[model samples]
Target: MSDKQLTELLSLINQRQDRLAFACKEIADWIDSQGDRPVAGKIRDSLKAVEADEVLVKKTLTSLTLERPLPRFR
Candidate 1:
């Protein structure tokens, strides 16, 4: 695919990741309200990796858009 298409796809993936993270947080909040602090904490901890991966995705997207052109994939 072209670089432009790849960038768009990555952008969409990043957006989905953000939404997933938001949903997870909402679920965690509900669980905490239900007095399951441990489960909620675990959920929050698990989100750490998702959050970190988000940063990496953002960086890669930036590089893909701004750096030299990449070879088109078949």
Candidate 2:
């Protein structure tokens, strides 16, 4: 992919990570308020995905930064 495209994708990926983190935190808080249960366990698993997404985003950013492409003027 072109550098511009990669940059845009990185921005989107980071944005998604941020959103997921916010949602996961809120869900965890709600679960805590509701008391421990089987459902809370499931919610915790989803929160773990947010952590994974952060790692994925970091990987994507590393790959994007290591790549080089022809410059485009607009």
Give per-model CA RMSD: 3.9, 5.3
lDDT of 2 by residue, 1-74 (tens): 87768778878868887887788778877877889656767877777877777777788777777757668999
Instruction: For model 1, state the Cα shift of residue 39 in Å.
Output: 1.0
Writing each residue's lDDT as its tens digit, candidate 1 over 1-74 gives 98889999989988988999999999999999999999999999999999878767888999889868557999
In model 1, pairs of residues that clash are none
Off by over 4 Å in 1: 67-74
Report how far residue 8 has shifted in candidate 1, in Å: 0.5
Cα lDDT of all candidates, in order?
Answer: 0.92, 0.76
Q: After superposition, how far is residue 50 of candidate 2 from its true place, in Å?
A: 3.4
Indicate the worst ten consecutive residues by lDDT in candidate 1.
62-71
* Collision count for each candidate, in order: 0, 0
Question: What TM-score fits each model?
Answer: 0.84, 0.60
Q: How many backbone clashes are present in model 2?
A: 0
Query: Over 4 Å off in model 2, which ranges?
Result: 66-74
Supply candidate 1's per-residue lDDT for 4.
Answer: 85
